[model samples]
Target: MSIADPAAVREHLLAAAAAGHPLTYSELLGRLGHAFTRPKMRALCVTLAAIDEAAEAAGEPELAVLVVRQSDGLPGQGWWTGSWERHRFTGEWTGPEARRLIERLQGEAYRYWQERRGG
Candidate 1:
């Protein structure tokens, strides 16, 4: 699958979720045969947003939560701010509070996909 294919990306994220691990943005880009570039990262974020919308419609967890920054293991600013309405967070978007929120979301994705796969 290529980076341009949203479906393929979704599947890739689902696999990551099932494995119960989050991936760095650079790691995901590398898996898709691309380097870390701002434009490419923005494009990926677009795809990830679409994936999350579809997943939400299908009653699944947001798969994009599995992709995070290597520094803090939290998603990028776009996710924290843009998707804030969907989440019930009220604290700062850093430190332990933010980490717990991301971890909880990632954990939900992990359990959902893992159980669905009967693994």
Candidate 2:
């Protein structure tokens, strides 16, 4: 069981989210090509929580969407459960789905940071 390339997975996820599409398992494999594996994919999903934590520390509320966990679904699937202003959203997501959502938000945050830095 090899690990998926986190960076590649992250990039793909971010691009998909930016494009406004849900991340699907099949899609992930397609994007990853022969580099895909079940264990690596699962690990990638688990890593999303860390991204959320970082966003919270950075004081970005919208990024909280990545931290929320799904309550009613398979072990590796579900949607955001954390506080998002006044509303909450839920849905299914494979490993790729979670990764993409976090990456997309992070990309936005990165742009915000760059703007703040006057770059």
Best by TM-score: 1
The root-mean-square deviation over C-alpha atoms between each candidate and the true structure, in angstroms, is 1.2, 8.5
Which residue pairs in candidate 1 have backbone atoms (N, alpha carbon, C) closer than 3 angstroms, thus clashing? none
Whole-structure CA lDDT of model 2: 0.45
lDDT, model 2, position 61: 32
| Candidate 1: tens digits of C-alpha lDDT, residues 1-119 | 46668898887797798788988989999888899998988889999998899889988889888889888889998888777899967788889999988888998998998998754
Taken over the whole model, the C-alpha lDDT of each candidate is 0.87, 0.45
Q: lDDT tens digits, residues 1-119, model 2?
A: 11234445555544544454334554455556644466645565555445445545767533323222234212243224432333332334446665565566646655654455443
TM-score of each: 0.94, 0.40
Model 2 residue 1 lDDT? 16
Worst 10 residues of 1 by lDDT: 1-10
Q: Which stretches of candidate 2 lie over 4 Å from their true place?
A: 1-6, 34-38, 59-75, 78-119
